[model samples]
Target: MNHDAYPDNYIRGILNSVKSIAMVGASPVNVRPSYFAFKYLAQRGYDMIPVNPGHVGKDLLGKPFVASLRDIGRPLDMIDIFRNSSHIMPVVEEALTLDPLPKVIWMQLGARDDAAAAKAEAAGIKVVMNRCPKIEYGRLSSEISWMGVNSRTLSSKRPPAPTQGMRLSINRMSVGGGDTAASDRAAKNKSEQS
Candidate 1:
């Protein structure tokens, strides 16, 4: 899988539409990314089912944890995977075997298994690889609310500012509607007259 296959629109759609998510390999450890991501989404009004074999029967974020997708015993909109690529296939296989399969399979950053992804995609499951739902949600949902990025901001990182005049002009043109061509010509004429 070209890592770029995960589109922003797809991520946004999942983030908006899915009310309940089954988070595989979800950890209760505060330091883990999955723990924070799951908590963040839950706080955003998503019903998060924490799935980890070791954590079965444990409580996380006021919800009872299940060992696997099958143990959850209900329909799920999506599964946000925090597991490594090597451990993904079994989860994909199990997801397929669910009575009501999930709509999407999202693999977190640095996690991508082509064969597992193919299986999910072939089963009509929307596949997102090498992306974090938390980061994508922050971006597409406009939750960042800041231009500059830092430890304070949640975006992956911002690209450098445009260097060329044409790039700046195009950015302005894309946002505002006016007689831009005529305005440019008039501006050029005024500059020449000066």
Candidate 2:
């Protein structure tokens, strides 16, 4: 898997197959990129578990934070790393220890460790480096165009509307304000509907 040029299908396949994500370096603060990414992925219907040692026992988008991936106590489909490039190796090492290891290791934008990615892939876990799942989901789903961001590949045909329970609301009120309570309620509503 070349991190430099990932084929669209390879990226889309991972996104479509993953169901649960453990976000390493997740933040309780709403303004951070990690917070936005976490909220975005959760809203898209992925079971998002926040992993942050400092915020352990605290809540993010209504889910309690765990100190580490090992504390999740359940199978995870992906590990979305929000930590620095220098920190990825240790996290990958920890991820490999899980009983039913995650199917993917995704390093967030600006976070990439070639050595760590190699280790994970050699162990049979798929790796996506220096990419953000939130952005990838939007781009693949053609939802970014709704925000006026050109996704480059255009089609005359409109993408199908997301199913009722899976509707995506990219309204500034829902995303930019950093309102956890509203975000949590929205996530809860989405889950119940699902």
Candidate 3:
């Protein structure tokens, strides 16, 4: 997968496959991006765990924080790193030692380490860099577009009425989704038209 660009399907697949996520560098403050992302994924029904050594005893959105990845005490589908780029490798190394390795190592927006990503990929793990799962989830589900954001997907209709209130699946609108260049073109066109 390209570190600079991601196809919608790649993101959708991760989001759909990941039932549990370990959010490294999660924050107690509600205003932080980590807090918001954790809350959003948790609300979306993903089993979200917060990993922050400084706040191990604290809770974020009802989930108690763990000091490190090993403390999770359960298998994880993904590890969403919110730490700075320089700190990614240590986290990835620690993740590699887990018994049932995580399926994905996702570096958050503005937080990417090419070497760490390569290491994870070498271990047959999927890697995502410089992206936010929260944003991707919203974009793929057309939830963000409801707020007038360009989701890079074209659709003439809305998804079926939710069985649950305001809940959306990653499969909402998949048009122009899998091709990175194509999706960029669509977004560019939509932006230019606006």
Candidate 4:
């Protein structure tokens, strides 16, 4: 798979097939991009397990922050890397240790390791580098276009209405947990500003 030119079907296939994600290098801070990405992906229906040694035994958005991928104790379809590009090899190594290895290893924007990607791909794992799942979901699902972001592919036909009852959860343990309330509040504040 060419990381430089991923076709829509290839990207959509992975996103559609994945149900659970373990986000390594997740953060507790609200202003960080990882935090926002975690919240968005979770709300979009992916069971998000946040991995951060610094926040081990702590909770983020209702889900317990695991110290490492091995501690997740459940099957993860994908592992989204949020660390620096230089640090991806170790993360991929750890991911490869899992009994039922994740189907995909996604390196977030600005983070890419060709050697690590090749290793994972050799082991029969799909790899996506230098891309963000949240952004891809929005772009593929046309949600970004709704926000007036120029997504490049336009159509005269109206997009379908968004599904209702998709509220962000605040009590990290709730069905939609993790500082969701904070996200809601931030959204509300933004709406008020408008």
Candidate 5:
């Protein structure tokens, strides 16, 4: 896998496949990025476990904080590391100890340790560095785009939410494309400016 640039399909596949996520360094504070990311994913229906020793007894998004990944007491599909790059190795090492082993190890944006990623990859687990699953989920689902974020990627297919007004997900996406009218409008606008 190229750490520099990941294909949209690669990321979409992981987001669709993973049902459970353990976020290491998750914070109970509402203002923190980890807190926001955790909440967003939880709302998206992924089983989110907050892994932080500082607030072990406190409740995080209705789930008690777990001090470590091993305390999750169940298998995880992915582990989102929110710690600094220097601190990533220990987390990945612990992730490898899980009974069933997590399928993917994702290092948060600005957090990447090549050596640690190598180790995880060697163990047959997929590794994604310097990316946020929350942002990836939003971009792929068009949630960000709808909010004027210009995700750059567009799809004509209606979001397969299974219900009205719920966010899109790759799980139900059979095809990837753009809304041709929107695409043409944007292209024409750019040409006129030039």
Candidate 6:
């Protein structure tokens, strides 16, 4: 498949066929898109493994995080990458070294490395560039917000929304004083419940 243009059918096939995904550069911070996307995929019943040197040995959503693909020590169906274009080559090289190479190499939106993608494609590995698997899965499955209305069905009880004071707390927390605001929120939630 062309690295620049993957047919929709091919992309859909990969999404439907794969069971487990190793997410490289996944961050623990909930604010990051990588974290949200990874969390979303995991919640949707896909086996999502986080690979990040910084968080190696830590657990994200109960799945153990490994530092690199070589250390994962198991079969992976795909590697959904969140690293920069310049950093992708090494990851691809590592993936190639696996005894049974992964079926797909997915580069996140605005995260394409053409040369690296081509190398993987040359090895018979499917390449998906400049796209996010979470978005694609949700779109193709119609599991959530199919109309872009931000309304999605809940599998369980929905969580509370951020308070209106969330914005003020966000600004204050950026400068390192947000714990106090968070405490206030906890009290507010407790009071409202009572």
| TM accuracy, model 4 | 0.81
**TM-score: which candidate is best?**
3
Best by lDDT: 3
- Residues 1-194 of candidate 4 have per-residue lDDT tens digits of 87654655667778888989999999999999899999999988899999999998788899999999999998899999999989999999999999899999999987778899999999999999877898878776666656875443434555456675253221111122222346445544553454
The Cα local distance difference test for each model comes to 0.71, 0.81, 0.85, 0.80, 0.82, 0.74
How does each model score on TM-score? 0.73, 0.82, 0.86, 0.81, 0.83, 0.73
TM-score of 1: 0.73
Find the number of clashing residue pairs for candidate 2: 0
lDDT of 1 by residue, 70-139 (tens): 8888899999899987989999999999877898888887677778989998989888877777766654
- What is the per-residue lDDT of model 5 for residues 1-194, given as tens digits with 9 covering 90 to 100? 76765667788888889989999999988999999999989888888899999998998979999999988888899999999989999999998888998999999987878789999999999999877898888876767766776564745766555554354665434233432346545544553454
lDDT leaderboard ranking: 3, 5, 2, 4, 6, 1
Residue 54, candidate 4: Cα error in Å is 0.1
How much is the lDDT of residue 56 in candidate 4?
Answer: 86
The regions of model 4 sitting more than 4 angstroms off are: 154-158, 164-194
Root-mean-square deviation of Cα positions for candidate 1 versus the true structure, in angstroms: 15.0
Where in model 6 is the C-alpha error above 4 Å?
144-194
Pairs in steric clash, model 2: none
Residue-wise C-alpha lDDT for candidate 6, range 31-93, written one tens digit per residue: 998999988887666789999989977888898889899988999999999988788999999
Judge candidate 1 against the unseen true structure and give its global Cα lDDT, from 0 to 1.
0.71
Local error of candidate 3 at residue 33 (angstroms): 0.3
Query: Tens digits of per-residue lDDT for model 3 on 15-113?
Result: 888899999999989899999999888888889899999997779878899999999999999999999989999999999999899999999987777
User: Candidate 2, 95: how far from true, in Å?
Assistant: 0.5
